[model samples]
Target: MASRRTISSEKGFIEKGDATAFSPAALEKSNIAPAVPPGVIFKLLAFTFAMVVFPIGSYFATVNTIFRGKMSNSTFAGATAAFIANVVLIGYVIVAMKEDQSERLEAEEEAKKSK
Candidate 1:
């Protein structure tokens, strides 16, 4: 097995005894932020839960054909509910994106007016 890599930064992007040091000018020009917003993280987690739940629920819902020849109503209902909830969550993501676009456009318009 390979040894674990250790990272140490002193002055922005600079590592002790490492030649791949970034200059202040380079650091100033770079921009980075959280890979995903906290809200998005939660949304993703919820979607993932739905993804896992839906299949199991579906399998249970169709257990009559896949397994024992008896259908479970509760499993079918649960699967339907999860499907609907995920649909709503997906819609919310789309709406949020549209709202963000609107807000960005408004900011640009205001900037132009000021100029």
Candidate 2:
């Protein structure tokens, strides 16, 4: 994956792309605001919830199948759990990135004032 570069100043965050540059406030507004539309965030949250719940449901289903001599092994349950875990992990990463951006902006503001 290509790494991103951002410069946060007193006013706001700067957005930079590969070989691209943006002034302080220009970057902050674009980067800090939610990328997805308002409704989309809820939709994404709902989808992620489904991802976790479906795997849990599958685990029980797999168990039932095993009891009835249907599923020959535990692979299905394990795979489902792994998929759900990955999605949730990605969700956490997104949150962490957002928080980090906020913190960086705050620090930059303080530095500007001190100077």
Candidate 3:
């Protein structure tokens, strides 16, 4: 039987002896803040949830009620779901563009005031 060598946790094969482990303290010392705003994050999450829920929900709801559980009518249900998803995507893009434009205008006003 071959002998097994035990490696030290502090200095593994890939880790150097002088290297230190990552810690939150290093981040606390930095002056940087998160680049993304909370509102933007919330909007993105909401849109993502709608994209997932609305399409599947519409597909099932339509298939059951409107189509009366007919297999042939599933294609129409699928198309409706796809159209809803596309609408959600377009809405997100429009919101993002408007938000970007507003931010740009605010920045321009700040620059004018600073001059």
Candidate 4:
């Protein structure tokens, strides 16, 4: 069973601890704005490549000392760094995409009223 409650305040009407998520308006209204999504296989491929392959390959290259700048370079250290970097990059992309619509269409009513 669930409980129902009403919230009346001077500010506005809202529910307390509702399943509804952070009630936020469009990003354009705020200082932050969303970026456009990529299109086509090439864009996706490139995105995933940057997200996945490069880090893995870099890890191997770093760990094996496959290519090192100097004798002091530690293969293990390089590999660890590559792995961490790859994870960070992937997370960054996911967060960026989840933000919001880069562009929003004007409400039909609002447009009509303007004319």
Model 2, residue 80: C-alpha shift (Å): 0.5
**TM-score for candidate 2:** 0.37
Give the root-mean-square deviation of each candidate in angstroms.
Answer: 8.3, 16.6, 5.7, 12.9
**The candidate that achieves the highest TM-score relative to the unseen native structure:** 3
Worst 10 residues of 4 by lDDT: 10-19
Look at candidate 3 and give me any clashing residue pairs: none
**lDDT (10s digit) by residue, model 1, range 58-97:** 6565555444543665566556657766775776678679
- Runs with alpha carbons beyond 4 Å of true place in candidate 1: 1-21, 46-79
Writing each residue's lDDT as its tens digit, candidate 3 over 84-110 gives 999999999999999999999999999
Per-residue lDDT tens digits of candidate 4, residues 49-98? 66666666666667556546656557665657677766767776775565
lDDT score of model 4? 0.58
Q: Which candidate, 2 or 3, has the higher lDDT?
A: 3
**Candidate 2, position 8, lDDT:** 58
For all predicted structures, in order, the TM-scores are 0.40, 0.37, 0.71, 0.32
Q: Write model 2 residue lDDT over 1-115, tens digit each, in one string.
A: 9986644553332332333345565676575666766765775687677667867876777666644464655665677567777776777678767867987999999999999
